[model samples]
Target: MSYDSAKAAFADWGVDTETALSKLAEIPISMHCWQGDDVVGFEAKTGNSGGGIQATGNHPGRARTPDELRADLEFSYSMIPGKHRLNLHACYLDTDQNPDRDEIEYSHFAPWVDWATDQGLGLDFNPTFFAHEKADDNLTLSHPDQGIREFWIEHGKRSRDIAAQMGAALGSPVVNNIWVPDGYKDTPVDRMEPRQRLENSLDTMMATKHDKAQMLDAVESKLFGIGVEACTVGSHEFYMGYATRKGTLLCLDMGHFHPTENVADKLSSVALSVDEILLHVSRPMRWDSDHVILLDDAILQMAQELVSAGLLDRTHIGLDFFDATISRTAAWVIGTRNMQKALLRALLAPWDRLKSAENNLDYTSRLVVTEEIKDLPYATVWAEFCDRMGVPSGQSLISDLHQYQAGVSGRG
Candidate 1:
């Protein structure tokens, strides 16, 4: 059936497919640059993943240079149906002159701004708190050593400055996220000190004033990590209080929480407190593995909650996984496309009926309507969305990826 037929089908359920498609088109997913190289940033001479984040699988054709990474990203954006932004970690900065992370400056990323300008892509930034020598003993900002803490603080300051420049260049506010792996392998004798140090370090970093329109600061929290199994200093509770008191955006990484923890449930609660939020959507099998995102139940719930809470515009969505097990470009397309698909499905939901059923205490009707919407022509509408996007639908997108791999990424 044609997209027009699909539109009529959805309209029967009171869903304006046209409006949904338009809104979905405007929601740009921030694709992470680390995926193109399996989290091994361009500055890492040894390809060390550091900070308990490791990308499994040794897929061939990984981009080795910034130029190659950008080329792969160019091809990735082509396969994807809409405009997107690039999320760059501080470690990925260009290295014409080998400056350590502490000494790095926005000048190193001038080429990136030029490229993003040409591609018409927005930019997001992250401070690399791990995989560096300064991250002594699985601690960075929370380190007891004042010099090491100062080093990371300086890097954070510089990263925010670079993101501000990116926003100025791209005509959009940049989301600058900071997720440090500061914790203890075993139970620490003192937890308050580490948390206090982190708080102080963050104060120093955010003390540097920047235009709010140009750069928005956000801090991410993790329950635990590979090495830091005992406790994570920057726990959800810690960042929650800090974000509320300090007025910074809070980032919720899907993989950072426990397996049973529903990150979706936290959306409404956090939304009431913070002005804006950043979401790092990824799949976690057993831990923070950073697996590529799929159209799983967890993802569906996350999107539904975001839509139901009327936060589609207030929250910034970004992909945060490095699955080197598959074709790098395929990983990008799969994760990004699945993210769009989940959001579209949520948009098509009959929220009025669902909420009315809840208000009337009609549990039976609510459950029925919820299960019934699952069987709608979502795939049909998705294909139509691809058509509206002027990109290939169904398995046809695979062919485009294959052709690019043969002509471009495969060359690496």
Candidate 2:
């Protein structure tokens, strides 16, 4: 199973292994920082920190500070192949003085900009919307209290500014994403009130324009959360229409949809309307469990749609899972590596042949060829890609990962 052998075998079926690897290198997968710390940022805690989101498992070696999280991220990045970007939550600011969510400033994140500069990584951002006094009712931007809603609106605006600063410093466009928990636990009589408030807050926050080259704005919707079980203010329809009208990226988190629904099915419709999109790659069991990603059917289908629709450039792929059951560093490595593998698998497909079969009304041949290509020596090509990228290939990273768990991760 040499690289040359795999390349020649794929070539027989109108696929170019070399081209797939090259294209994969160009796509920057944004690795999330919260995975290294169980989503607990350095912000000084006021009250209970669990804000609808839950990270199950008490894995030791969880990072407790900004420096430790950055160190863990540095090591994890070394194991994963290809150059990538880093995704940050607003709560992860590296500053001595902790500022309230709405009061946060760009200077607080200057240290992160310096680190990204040295690592050659671009940065993306999110505004922390829950786990605060204002959101005790599980509402922030959509709260009926106009004062509370305005506070979150300011936080969202500041986050965009910080993200824009990161992009300006790193010479890349940073995507500032907003996801709030505004829902009712039990069935509420009134759902429109909260949604109306959410729409107004978004209009106010996005009213002031920022440089498009420096940053991009995105809105993420969720099906449900811990408290917001009955209804969610930012449902798919709300954000979809808002993104379409406002001209922003609509983030689609895999775990946000129902158990039976495939998130890939919504890609074509979103691509047709939104200017671009941001995808949060995660593994959800029965709900938004936030499990580490795998090379499963869901991931393959997503990659296929992205490539087949020619939406690779129009989509920003970011990892969004934090499983504390295993080594956190291993979680980062496994999830990111699997995402890259899925993208490579999709890229290596013989699209010309598949499309031609579909064009000729040869349904039987198309089905047969699609299934047959699954047995191709994809592992050989993946190993070659990792080798060429100057990283450990295959399960060889396990030995190094174990060493880090004992040495570095334990120190945290």
Candidate 3:
């Protein structure tokens, strides 16, 4: 049989074609993670480099025009849905330096909609801001550079217009997600200025929308590193407490913590509207490398806790990572697998047992973390069971089950 036919036959016997194809699709995926070249806003910038948008010099990486972007989307869909949840750093666009160029270059949001529709991928917009702007409580914009500041003011209008257009095209609110990288460095530099302007701009933008759009404003808080000393919305608890109070929800990026920090406890401490907590998944580590790790049991346990606490429901997960040396497709496939594994472990957890313990106040203390999922010292049984079910351990979870079935039938 041909490869496609054989693959179909295997799938007919209950193999997961999506998982298998995702593995092979990684080979041709381009490495464009943190380069910030992909976001629609970054397109307005003048110069490009191997890394991403720059101030003056030309970017070396293959510059994709609107047509090229559409083509890329087609290619990606043919292979598999390229990661829909996108995280673009705000500083990459540098609102302070080249606001006009950034806006001009990034006006390709319309084409992005065409591609997303063709591919059947949901757009989770994450415009991560690294600098601060000042807007009056009335939502009037302000900034340090008068020229660029005015440019940003206009850029906001352009962005809203693009979003409205895209929303109409998709028949859904296009401005779906927002995450602010605003916080203090050393001491509070902008103090309340950053927070005030960001909120003001968002409130104004939301008011302009003709239809209702679901907004998940991930107020991420940082510990220390880069120029960030105190993150504006550092932890889930912090975001829940602060952003929810400001009438915005939270987005929790897991990688923003030390090993010792109790992920569940920290999550619990945030007293706010349960809907305020939105989960953004990634292995916990510093900002050094976005290496995706296995979704261990700890994360599963925490997920269970969030579910019990009503903090997470219908919240989409973001596979956030950036490694230039690896194939873009491969990184996504691996990251997706890791994420899936964590989710599976969460699904398979002894929920009944966990819930019962909560009544005794002992459950929270016994909650598992991702670390436990890593050292599955007694995973031989589970692995064997998976093998017996014909689940493809490497690429196809279903193929692994099929192989197990064939082996069992042969033995019988």
Candidate 4:
């Protein structure tokens, strides 16, 4: 299964493997920083990861410092094909000062910006609404108290400013995403009040405008978290409407929906209202477990939708998973590579033929071709792309990952 043969086979279906690889190389997956540290940020006074967030397992080499995490990321990025961006949380600030969330300044994260610049990587950012004392009650932006709401709002505002600076430094637009864990564990008498408060806080936080080329605002929604079982203030309906009205990107986390719901389907529906989208690609495993993503049917369908619907350019694809059970760096390499593989698979799809069959209402042809194309030499094309990008695949990839893990095993 040489790449030439695979390319020829795809050519028979009117697909260009070279073009597919070219497109895939340009699309970057924003790898999350929390994965290396098990979501235990390096904040001066880091609080428990409440708000239904928990990363299980006690991997030996969990990154305990900013340098360690960056080292691990550098290694992980080395093994992954194509250039990618890094998604950072406010709590991951590499600073000597012990500033609280609301008091954080861009200076606190200047080191990260400098490092990213040196590595020729872009950056994305998030305001840490969880793992803070104010969010102990499972509420922050939508909290009943005005002071607490204002604090979170200020934090969000500062985060956007910092993200803008990062993007400006890197000459790329940084996605400043906001995901608050404001909900009630038990049923509440009045759900509208919290949502109203949340809307107000968001409006105030996003009042200041930055250059679109520098920063893009995004709001993420969740179905339900571990404790917020009864009601989640920032539900999908809430953020979708907010993003549509506010003219911001709506982040659709794959793990934020119900088990039966196909997140791939939402891309077309949401695209009608929202101009841009941010995807938090993760494996839920029945719940929002944040398991490292695999090249499964769900991910494949998502990649297909992004390509077939012509939404790739308007979408920001980011990884959102933290599994401490395995090598943290390995997790990043595996998940990021899987995402690229899925996109490559979709790119190689004979979409023109499939769409022609569907447009003509030829269900039999569509079904048969869809099923038959599954047997195409996708792996061969993927291996070629990896080789061109100077990264290993198959057994070589496994061996490289294990070697890195063994090297870093001495970390306390």
Candidate 5:
């Protein structure tokens, strides 16, 4: 869909509003980018911070304290020149260093609900879980948290309930981003057990949330690491394979593809609802090359095809970068700009011509090229158009321009 059409849809849905700065805080995006259904931000959990948690690896830095997290959000708002929004981790659930008891209050995330609401940003507070639960056909459940039966079970339930309550508190929909890191290491692994538990939990929550707000079960796929041997939504086929399953959808992470896989093809193969396609956008670089790279042409082509197929409006975009040495601001800035560049190009692309090419289908030698970057109008012009129409600036088009220009000069 065209950007204009998308904004019109937002306006029609009453999602476009001039929220007070105080209200902005309530929305996760106000503090970080990628809080929208179409996008959200994640603070990659890295070990370290003097907390001795050997579960993953020696952490580079400790998770930010609640106060520190709040301060950083405020700083992010101040320093990131344009109006930006984000989705924040109420707590890093996957981190081994984080206290099991403090799972719900990771970084005192609950308190921020009020603070974020006061800031005027709607919250997309996410709680997380690993595949700790295993089931047998006899319907037996087992968890590794030892006290899982007594503590974590209730903890997980309460977490979901509180999320619903937060939705009521903020009067907005909440998304529970689930990444089941339940896999084995050439050892015992029960994949069905975790899937059942997840589905059951989602069904329970969906029944309650049907009227007031929505819950998104964003299942992130994992590779063989940390004994996380199972892949939730292993491939787009896995997602489609389990349709009618209830209360969840597939979340595609860019890095999940095979080393030499074509992302566009993966996008095409997705069997879930078009609207259910949540995205975690980042480069899947190997070795010395920084994982952060421009969106390749194939991926853009795939996205364009999806857009033409009416799937673009349903997807949410987010950053899944893991840069420890770099400042979060720099990472977020680059990440956001890359997404915009990629999306805008996809939108303005001669999609009709590309579709025709698909029939003749030759991306080999003598490929037909589209307009030069110079020919495109500044994104700010589009933003200004949205502003005139009373739609709060969707993005800082000028910032996008500069970021793009930087890439042209090899500074990006």
Candidate 6:
């Protein structure tokens, strides 16, 4: 069970444990900021988190201020191995000015950029299309009224600029993702008009483009949400065609598909058409419950697909779960670490051997080797990775999490 023994075992299968660890360290997962505050952003005029967006639980130590959230993020990142990026929403702007979503400027988020710069972290951005008056009807860009649609359009445009500024400041490209809750609770009489309106709105909003090095555009799709059960305007097909035509990244949220769907399978299919991909990795308990991810089959398959298809370079992995039922900081660390673990497992797989078996139609060898590798000291290798990355594993990790919870228990 020792790391040395595990390394030798993997070497016998034509896998290099050192190479796997090196590759895992290079991949950075973008952690969502909303998890710290239960998606109740620091906006002055925040509305109900409608549109199927709700974080359940009354866990103590929910971050209430920008500073507190940053502190919590700092602690979470400390426990997670390797460098990572922070995914920020426009509503999380840290500023004294009370700006509406459409009126938001880079100045409102300058503090976050400064903090990220100091911490040596990259930044990703999302335009807050929900939790606002305009989104009360579960529509924004696809709103029937031009005035309502324009309001959201302006917000989207402003978000791109802010993301570009952040990316420029950090000297890295920021992924500016757009996800709208435009859908109908009941079946719509006509879906065409709304989609057409959304298409036009997107065209107008993305007319002015920043350098790709500063910002990359991504459009996220959803199957359905709480009130929008009957219809989701930004379905996978809608955004897949849009992203393909517009040459923008397509965001495939794990929780945004049918319960039985395997999102990992879509990576290779979508990659053929789109230049880049953005993944909002999360766990869905029957629905888009946004549960903190565990090292389960779904995650393992996702990581395996990324590794097998050679999609790591073109894919951006980001965590998008907000669970307030536990220590918020711990939720971030656990989910992000699980994602890292999945990638590490995938990296250590004897991919070449498996592929050769499959290519030769050696079904028995393929099946046997795949199942046999499951018992191969993966935990031992993972522990070595944690140790090398200066993070705790096993009981030590649990103790650290509990200590953090006790420290923040007085948030009430």
Could you estimate the TM-score for every candidate? 0.97, 0.98, 0.60, 0.99, 0.62, 0.99
State in Å the error of residue 146, model 3: 6.0
**lDDT by residue for model 6 (125-174), tens:** 99999898778888899999989999999999999999999999999999
In candidate 3, what are the lDDT values of residues 320-409, reduced to their tens digit? 454434333333445554544444334434445555657677755446522333343223322332344333344554453344324323
Worst 10 residues of 4 by lDDT: 43-52
| Overall local distance difference test of candidate 1 | 0.89
Residue 39 accuracy (lDDT) in model 4: 93
Q: Is candidate 5 or candidate 6 better by TM-score?
A: 6
| Over 4 Å off, model 5 | 1-63, 77-84, 92-110, 130-151, 187-214, 229-244, 271-275, 287-306, 356-366, 371-412
Model 2's TM-score against the true structure: 0.98
Question: Would you list the rank order by lDDT, best first?
Answer: 6, 4, 2, 1, 5, 3
Per-residue lDDT tens digits of candidate 5, residues 268-299? Answer: 56644434666666566541122443656644
lDDT of each: 0.89, 0.90, 0.42, 0.93, 0.44, 0.93
Q: lDDT of candidate 5?
A: 0.44
Candidate 2, 221-320: lDDT as tens digits: 9999788888998999999999999999999999998878899889999999998999999999999988999999999999999999899999999999
Reference-based lDDT, residue 199, model 4: 98
> How far does residue 167 in candidate 6 sit from its true spot (Å)?
0.5
Regions of candidate 3 where Cα sits further than 4 Å from its true position = 1-107, 128-150, 172-175, 180-210, 213-220, 230-242, 257-259, 263-271, 274-276, 310-314, 360-412
Cα lDDT tens digits, model 1, 48-123, are 3445788888777888889999989988888788899999988788767887887888889988999999999999
Q: Give me the overall lDDT of model 2.
A: 0.90
lDDT of model 3, residue 348: 37
User: After superposition, which runs of candidate 4 have C-alpha atoms over 4 Å from their true positions?
Assistant: none
